[model samples]
Target: MEHIKIGDEAPDFDLPGDGGTRVSLSAHRGKIVVLFFYPKDDTSGCTVEAIDFTALKPDFDAAGAVLVGLSPDGVKSHDKFKKKHALAVDLASDEDKTTLERYGVWVEKSMYGRKYMGVERTTLLIDRDGRIARIWNKVKVPGHAAEVLAAANDIG
Candidate 1:
């Protein structure tokens, strides 16, 4: 797992996305990129986080930022989740976990004394130059999207 920090160039990825589209970090050059990695699609926390980001999509757009929600879920699941919630943000699928590992969000998690591998609920703000501006790890759903928007606005 790579430990990416502020000022580090974000690892670029091209993955299948909802609506039969492909998402790539490099494709949004010259724009702030918000890449939110969640554990799964349609889960409670993930759903809230996705909706929150979706709600703030216009603000993010006005700030010259592009938002993408990523998980290990397949494109089919992503399509369903987006349609079910009417999400405005793009949802990328890292079915093989390659992108997840590159971002260092895939990890071993313990729940009820059971060990499992899952996403760490991380969000990264990539500057227009492709360098990381901010990173939120172990993200809490409440107000997280707004916080990220503020950060994006700050950097712009």
Candidate 2:
């Protein structure tokens, strides 16, 4: 799949979210969208990233941006993770990884010399016009959400 670049229109995605809501990228067209694709729910890095984003969600909302985190876990898993962490950001379940592939986050990964397919940690900030404003790949956990929020504030 061709990797989506800055200024490219973000590929639309529709997936089941926590609380039984259907999240669609098109639904957030008029607002800045923060689409973060992570490997899984309730994992260490994923948990920290989600918590950080949730802590800054009100600021993102104030900047007219909606933060959505995506993973291959199902909605039930997402709900449990959210509840466990009291996460404030939205979490979308992408069991098939179609949207992850579209965003170029699904890739081959190796840990302990074992290789497998997984979602690479990535974040895309989309402008109000639905264009990609910024892309972060192989994301580090700390200070990442704040950086993205700053970019979103500038773009939105």
Candidate 3:
């Protein structure tokens, strides 16, 4: 698995989002993109992260940034989860894990001595030029959204 480094051109990918709309990084060129990847939808940590990001949507927008969360879940799952939480952030479905793999967020995780492949909570900040500005890997959910927001706001 090749992990992308900062300054690399943000990989362009199109995936189905909550409303059956195809979300693509290329489409958002010349715009700051805040892309976060979580292990699953509706889970405790993921829920907190999603809600936090949603709460800061206005601030992100004011800073000219787009926020998107992606997971290895289907569109239907994303729809239910967003509706359940009244989330305003865009959620993309990556059931085939193609985008996740491309971004290098999918990896082996272990719990209680058991190992399994899963999404490693990660976040990437892509500048308006479509190059990666920052990356947060194995993210800690608490205060994460705010941190990312601060970074986005600094994108001048």
Candidate 4:
């Protein structure tokens, strides 16, 4: 799949999310949306990223934007992660990886010199018009949510 680019319509997807809700990307239309894709539910990097976003939920909400996290983990795992971290943002389970592939975040990785398929940490900022405003690929977990929020405020 091709990478989602600015000005393109954000692909729609419905996945089982944390808290027993089904989250659809299209449902967030007409609002600024932060779509962050991570590798797993509670790994070090993913956990840090989730916590950061959760901590900034108030700021993001005040800015009239919503944050949604995605990972291949099932809804059960997501529930555990959120409970353990007291995360404020919603997490969606992309167990089938359909949404991840559409955004081009399901990618190759190298760990211990072995190549494998995994989620390449990424974040997409969708504008109020349901169009992609910006994309942060190959993301570094630190300070990423703040950066995304700044961009959302700028583009929203």
Q: Estimate the TM-score of every prediction.
A: 0.99, 0.97, 0.98, 0.96
TM-score of candidate 1 relative to the true fold: 0.99
At residue 50, give the lDDT of candidate 1.
Answer: 95
Candidate 1 Cα outliers beyond 4 Å, as residue runs: none
Clashes of 2: 0
Model 4 local distance difference test score: 0.90
Roughly what TM-score does model 2 have, to 2 decimal places?
0.97
Residue-by-residue lDDT tens digits, candidate 4, 1-156? 776788999999899999899999888888899989999988999999999998899889988899999999999999999999999988999888888888888888899999999999888899988998898988998888889989988975
Tens digit of per-residue lDDT, candidate 1, span 1-156:
999999999999999999999999999999999999999999999999999999999999999999999999999999999999999999999999999999899999999999999999999999999999999999999999999999999998
Query: Largest TM-score belongs to which candidate?
Result: 1
> What is the clash count for each candidate, in the order shown?
0, 0, 0, 0
Compared with the true structure, all predictions reach lDDT values of 0.95, 0.92, 0.93, 0.90
After TM-score superposition, the amount by which residue 48's alpha carbon in candidate 2 deviates from its true location, in angstroms, is: 0.4
Candidate 2: 10-residue stretch with minimal lDDT: 96-105
Arrange candidates, best TM-score first: 1, 3, 2, 4
Model 1 CA lDDT for position 45: 98
Error in Å for residue 54 of model 1: 0.6
Q: Give me the runs in candidate 2 sitting further than 4 Å from their true place.
A: none
Give the poorly placed runs of model 4, Cα more than 4 Å off.
none
